[model samples]
Target: MSFIQTLNDAWSRTQSLLCVGLDPEPAKFPAALNGRPDAIFEFCKTIVDATAPYASSFKPQIAYFAAHRAEDQLEALIAHIHEKHAGIPVILDAKRGDIGSTAEQYAKEAFERYKADAVTVNPYMGFDSIEPYLAHEGKGVIVLCRTSNAGGSDLQFLSTSDGKPLYQVVAQLAAQKWNDNGQLGLVVGATFPKEIETVRGIVGDMPLLIPGIGAQGGDVEATVRAGRTANGAGMLINSSRAIIYAGKGDDYAQAAAEAAKKTRDTINQYR
Candidate 1:
């Protein structure tokens, strides 16, 4: 099955838009996992198992592993998700943006090496920077548009000759031009619900990966009302620190599960 098909199945099977984000920060790991060489994988695998019932997707940010030289653990965690939580799409949140062979290698890293179902990419360098990822048939290529940070306005809000913000232009291009293979999706932050609504209008039913809900304080009601498809599904709402770090004790996995369940239930209430 294709990435989108698998994602659709996940939404139906789990009745969720929640995309659990695995951004492991060792400094914040629980006491039980401290000093373990495989702490990153162990912590994340435990959380994945505990919360798999409520999540429609899992996004593991690559930088979290690379910074600690834990790429092997990252690979193991993704493999474990595939093995134990079938149908739940794992998105490698690498946000890679390069051109030519470099971009191809990045694509290889995300699709072949990491074995992620989907991967996020930056659109700053235009179509050529994104084309290589599209070469990997059926793999999801999510483009960054209208990011959640306040500093994003420095560039995203700047008006182009079309009198629309740069972000909107990116949305138009991604929807009409870049999505020929139907493998494209957009990352529109949950913090910007109005922009999310606007992007949804431009992209129609294209799936959106929305971050900023939990630790970022994005309003769930506003995010759902703005981003959901007409049928009330078209989002992979992500929450990282808020869900994964819900507890710091031995029962951290259980705490993460409860947090994920509450978040999934709250999102459903609005949907």
Candidate 2:
């Protein structure tokens, strides 16, 4: 299935919009697994299994693994998701942006090497930087629009000649010009619910990979009201630290499950 179809199917099957983000940090790991080899994989795998029932998708931030020299663990983690969770898509949160061969190599890294179902990318480099990923048919190329960080406004809010913010222009391009394959999505921060509403209006029913809900304090009700489609199914509401690190002991996985379930239920209430 295409990335969008698989995402929509997962949404229907799981009846949840919650996207479990895996951003493992060894310093934050529980005592039982803190110094263990391949602990990154072990920690994320446990969370995946515990929260699979409530998740519509999983997003693994690549920097977390790479920073710890755990790239192989990241690969294993994604493969485990494909094997155990089946239809649940994995989005590689790499935010890669380059042109020509460099972009192609990055695309290969995300799809061929990591086997990510989709990837978050920086569109600051323009359309050519994105075309290489589109070349990989059925894979999702999610462009960063209004990111969650406050520093994002430094560039994303700049005015264009048409009196529109840069992020809005990016949304317009992704929705109209750049979405030829119907596999594109936008990363609109849940922190900016009003911007999300503006982007949703521009993009129609395109899928949105929303971050900032849990640890970043994005409001669930406002996010849903602004981002959901007519069917209440166009957003992937992500919560990472609040869910994965809910417990610091041996029962961390169970605690994570509880947090995920609560988040899923809270999101469903608005839908």
Candidate 1 C-alpha lDDT tens digits along 69-162: 9999999999999999888999999999998679999999999999999999999999999999989987999999999999989999999997
True-structure lDDT of candidate 1 = 0.94
- Compared to the true structure, candidate 1 yields what TM-score? 0.99
Off by over 4 Å in 1: none
TM-score of each: 0.99, 0.99
The pairs that clash in candidate 2 are none
Quantify all predictions' global Cα lDDT against the true fold: 0.94, 0.96
- Write down the worst ten-residue block by lDDT for model 1: 1-10
Number of backbone collisions per candidate: 0, 0
Model 2: residue 30 alpha-carbon error in angstroms:
0.8
